[model samples]
Target: MGKKDVSISDSIYDRIKERVEGTGFDSVDEYVEYVLREVVEEEEEEEEPYTEEDEEKVKERLRALGYMD
Candidate 1:
């Protein structure tokens, strides 16, 4: 895959540099890529469409809480 350049504040870069010291990451770019990939994976996982059973459960909860008739 082709790589592109991204800019971040010096302070953030310094923080990441310090955090990666004594760890497996060789550079700030690798650490940032790993973290961003993890976050994106989590977001994708949460994007699953709600099912009819899921909607019914939410409605039932609302009824129990007196938010619905």
Candidate 2:
């Protein structure tokens, strides 16, 4: 896929440039793309949604410990 251009604040750009010097990144854009890809992938792995059965189990546990009526 082709890359897209995105704008960021000068301060953030400077920060990325500073880190790029010692890092294996060839440029700030490369580092940003890598970081963004990792973040996007991590976010994609979402947890399953809560269901009524799960809520009922919690209530049962609370009742066993005398925390619920």
Candidate 3:
């Protein structure tokens, strides 16, 4: 895969550098990539359709809490 360069503010870069100081990440770019991947994965998971069983469970909880009739 090819790589691309994206720019960030110097302060943000320094903050990420400080965050990864004692961790496994070797550079700000690596930590950013890892975080971006996690966020993308979460968004993808959230795109799945909500089914009727899911709706029923939510309704049941709401009813238990007296928010539903």
lDDT of 2 by residue, 1-69 (tens): 897899999999997898677556789999899879856965785475548997698688556534589
State the local distance difference test value for candidate 2: 0.77
lDDT of 3 by residue, 1-69 (tens): 889999999999988888777666788999899879867976897978669998798688556534589
Instruction: Please give, for residues 1-69, the per-residue lDDT of candidate 1 as tens digits.
Output: 999899999999998898777666788899899879867976887868768998798788656534589
Ranking by TM-score: 3, 1, 2
Each candidate's root-mean-square deviation in Å?
A: 12.7, 14.5, 11.2
Q: Give candidate 1's error at residue 40 in angstroms.
A: 0.6
Per lDDT, the best of the predicted structures is 1
TM-score of each: 0.65, 0.64, 0.66
Error of 3 at 37 (Å): 0.5
User: What local distance difference test score does each model get?
Assistant: 0.81, 0.77, 0.80
| Residue 7 local lDDT, model 1 | 96
Ranking, lDDT, top scorer first: 1, 3, 2
